[model samples]
Target: MGSQAPGKGAKGPRILNVNVGVLGHVDSGKTSMVAALSTKLSTAALDKHPQSKERGITLDLGFSSFSVPLPAHLQHLPYDELQFTLVDCPGHASLIRTIIGGVQIIDMMVLVVDITKGLQTQTAECLVVGEVATSNMVVALNKCDLVPAEERPKAIRKAQKRLAQTFNLTKFAGVPMVPITAKPGGGGTGTSAAPDAEGLEELQAHLVAMVPTQPRALAAAGPLLFSIDHCFPIKGQGTVLTGTVLQGAVAVGDTIELPGLKLSKQVKSMQVFKRPVTKASQGDRVGICVTQLDPSLIERGLACAPGTVPTFNGAVAAVEKIRFYAGQVPSKAKFHVSVGHTTVMASLTFFGLPDGQGVSQEAALVQMIENLGRMALTGVPMPFDKSRDYVYQGALVIGAKFDGDIHGESCRLAFYGRLVTLINPSKPAELQQLRVYKMKEKRGVIERINEDQGNAIVRGMFKKETDPAIYTGLRVVTGRGEDGVIESSFGKSGKLKVHFAKGIQQAGRSSSDNAVILRCKRYINEHDRKRLRQ
Candidate 1:
């Protein structure tokens, strides 16, 4: 496909595509910045949504492109042209899901910040998203023209210092920040004459310099996985699915599956930024035209080689709580989980190795990345191994030794993780294989002791309606460090007989503080099983 030249009517040279996400707070000129730099636009570009035009804020993702000659560093590659596809993501707090979905496809990011406003709430949120999505970033300090000529330099320096302080805690520390006025004189409405943008050329230069070093692993090697962001039927032709190619490659005649709908369609044609193309590969934003599928059935989803993507009910991941979130992340709580371009509600259960049994923090992070990479390559979950014992956590909290005070108004990014397993709830056999459990403990006073029989009647451990038979064989411990086993049910009122082989300690028998404690693990999958049955 790289060897193939452009179609007869196509204007540009053979192009190598690169996706750059344009993200920022609402009204930070993200869309205007793209418009100033882009030379071409896709069907869905530039606030095309009716609600967006009426409300004067972006509510969905927008697409546009601009082409440049291949840089000196990339001349060794195949194509002579480098096309930067601008993905303008909505910055509204409520539309964060859309921003997250857009970030997954980009190779780098251009974070736009209002120079006058410095870093707002949504701007900080975009930075957090960039930290998780991509490694390369360039900060665009926009609306520089608003400052007086005498104060411009000082204002820019002050904003830069504040941004430096903010990024000091993030991975994007030391990233380049360029002053730009995407739309000078505050002209956003279409009625006004278009104004020449300031610093756009310099911004583009920084983007081109970063392109050569950006990572594009498995760009054309893995199984075809195309993320469909827009689907619509043409008048005479078939339906067109416009999106970015996430993995592998696809040609005009290859068969593709809509895994979400359990349907397959052959690619009748392909295009990149409205230019006809014979093939498209990973990282290239292209439109695949197909037939015999209703456009309404798919708004945004994955289209891949048959049988590559699977449908599952639950998943397990190696999660780290986001430091900015102030609230606790409790287990079994439902969160809006975004995978690729789809966001769904998912119940989370957290487990880790015992205190002394766990690895170092650095080692855990490395292992987590590797686990995520494996799951990404193959759409299968890492099953919970039953042979190993794990400690269950009631809530995810930052250790006081590691946590630092943060602003009260920061975005709530609870936690992030790499998928470990994709659970199929309908299969009881599969559910039994998941070994994640919650540790339960109960304590009660020993009402009476039968020293001669080497047994004691435990009264407070079980309630009136509780059945002790289920825990008859389990072990128990006393506050004074005596070990005992549950022998059998004692009486009708939910009491049990506990036997101590070494006999109860003398101090424990007399001390009111001495109490019996029982600890056990309750598998989480059992609860899921009961929920499904109900």
Candidate 2:
């Protein structure tokens, strides 16, 4: 029944939704670089807010998209047939946790290095992280334009050579390093916005060749990993879950198998961008509506779906110990771990090796004990189990000696036995028009910022009186700033309160008004201004 996903209800030529992440040292221009990769102009161009500009650091993740025009050979394919979502990850040491978080969910990735600066400490660290976590990678020798014409190619070469010699990133063994500037390309001054268009085109062709138009085959079927990266509610609509499809597909009424985060909600609706769609395919990013959950339950890095996907128990005998590299958080460690969107409290218990051979001793037996919780399980060799926790324990996974290796041979998710391969929606005309319009609209550019956290803006039309989606969407987006009583409560009072400035007041503004939403910029950030202008 399953050969390859046939083009059944496709809206365009076979569409492959590819999500690529940028990893590099701080200030290596990961964000600026992605802005250049987009098909349209983006405000990430001026993200140099006072705080970020002052420190030259990207605190949160930034997102943008662009379409890879099919090769002249594939042009006959719908123009928007192949779309790519690029996530710009932070490179700052302080945000190492967040940076690595980006790699956990992506498929293929691009590593950006400043040609002029070569690879820094984090670049090397990021390489090792990728080697251990992902298999496909490409390097972008950013700022070739910074070097003298005679020196640029050599600079790019040195960087490429470094990838092999330094980190031994064999997965990207023969991958070419393209040189260009992210500042202009990131759409700042529009410098090389196309970033050596020909080279980029060649790179895309190479990627397509490597990614193979088929989903990577796995052992079992049924459970799908839906990594939630972004979430928002449409005015009259309910909540939407957006993320790259790690594995599996979803049709109008299909049940999802996201075992790790313990979510088993039925999909209410599905869409690509804002356009309605009947199905979602693997390796694609989609916004799905789900039932039976508070918006708070959904956060970034959440793996979810309906029914039993897989699960591992607190007492998975094979486990030895879990630890991170030096300078990594928690000397002894204690915190929450997530599978899909499910958060579980876990305690770090070091075990296995006796502390001789190398980083991780070669032995398997209880070494130390760290207390963990029920809802959340500690990180093991593979993806977490469903609510019940039945993750298969394997030798390679348990055998591997790493202070902390997120995967093990035994840890794997089940593939859905029956499937509906979505023909890439064949909506070229629709894609291009939307790209042009969306590229111009600039929505996420404002108060609502990085959705991995709470929303800053409350978007809804005010009525003289009557029903509101808030009744449906709820005042869910309300809540407080990074601090205050708001975090403690939701919906009615406590944390959800917003104080409106006297000069600017909503008609229904309650009598008391000083707090004015702890959310959104007090003086209005550039993004807010843009939304206002729009």
Candidate 3:
């Protein structure tokens, strides 16, 4: 459909920037739905990943933009424009992390569902993430062309029932689900090449009715907070960063700082949806040309702001382990925490004193560490940077999604919280000692010995370490307090062998009967750990 010219004597409608993310299970037609909608306005195709072309599965986040005309009745409204940034998120379980990244910037979502498949595992995961991100939602009953005509109504009804129950507490409960056949190349075909089941025009109108355009009031007035999603170099443009401006605005020549990276750069130029603009504000998907920074240094998950970005090593937040998360999060247990597009390994401590005291007794902590019932307010150990303030004061604290089992197919969400505190750096000596102990833990276990080579065997903490310098000569202490040096790897199993510094004849314990635990010469004083709690 072509855009109608503005009525004479009236100003052309201003484009309202809105971000809508597409999510669903693999083969649920999310990308195809995006393509179907892109044709309605000036939009590029959504699936641009090379692997997407090869495997027909979206491997990463794909983006496109299009404009929808305001309804005739609403044409007189202050904002007569509906410009939407369609973020197509990957549907495969392995790529859920990418979907979480996309969710951070989107104002709302369009959940595509394959009519025949109904709700799948990843589909539910997508919804859960959307809930955690607090994004508004609309459901797209896609692939109507594939379902048999006689069975279509039943499928739609069943889906509605399931969705209603799923969204009982959500604002989108009872939200309309548009049934449409989303063809790959943009546009849809009904049974036997008929017109779209839910016409494209109707879907467009529904989108506008369902999701309100973001207000420019606070978004334009607040401090700038832009979470970068992609960065690359344009031959003449130097380095360009593309992302949705989460808050405030930035003009050309404005200086931006990335506290997490400890770097600052100047904004050489800026564009909104490819149109050169003097400035870009919140909610607009923008491309920023930066000067005095290497393109390779730019990465996703880093925030760019006009003022100082608060750096934090950790946060205090209300946490809840999903009912399905069966794994235990022992104190100091390593879990991968993903918030926005950044994932980092973090340690979790269930027993936090009102004062920074030493770790609580295991029995007491275990009793209080209930994964079910009301959400528990807990302290998570974030990466500590000693050079900056130890707390984040930003209004928006990135909430991490905890996955206790990274290798499993289960879509379990274990943790959710805002970053509040940064790792305290006041005690450098104790912190350094802790680091040495962790490094030793990563490489100090002896599995067995090779009879022919007469050497005890071991493996690197990460399964294997090709760089011998990292493990060799490292000091280690065993469970029985036996001191040793990491000699070498046994073979390929990531196990490591250590040679004891002194004889153990008096103890009379063989390597087979004994185990090892990494230790540091200077351990964190129990008193120091207690002081931190204060």
Prediction RMSDs, each to the true structure:
8.9, 26.8, 15.2
Question: If ranked by TM-score, best first, what sequence of candidates would result?
Answer: 1, 3, 2
lDDT of 3 by residue, 1-534 (tens): 011123234455556667888889988877766765663321223555566676777877767767867656546545566677888888887776787778877777888887767878888778777666654677888777666679878877887787778667555577677778776233321112223435456667666775543244433666777778887787866788887777677778788877656777888877665566666677777778886667776567555563446555554444545444455645556566665566656556543222133443333234335531112122344465322322223322222344434345565665555553344434564334332211113333445544444345544354453555445566666556756666766566666766764643232256533555543222243443311110
Over the stretch 88-192, how does candidate 1's per-residue lDDT look in tens digits? 999888777788879888889999999999899889888988887777899999999999989999999999999999998988889999999888887552312
Of models 1 and 3, which has the larger lDDT? 1
Please report how far candidate 3 places residue 77 from its true position, in Å. 7.4
Task: Give the TM-score of each candidate.
Answer: 0.74, 0.54, 0.65
- Candidate 1 global TM-score: 0.74
Top lDDT model? 1
What's the C-alpha lDDT at position 171 in model 3? Answer: 52
Give me candidate 2's TM-score against the actual structure. 0.54
lDDT of each residue in 102-138, candidate 2, tens digit only: 6655667788888878878677656655554467788
- Number of backbone-clashing residue pairs for each candidate, in the order shown: 2, 44, 20
Model 3 TM-score is 0.65
Q: Candidate 1: misplaced stretches above 4 Å? A: 1-12, 189-195, 212-214, 353-410, 426-428, 437-534
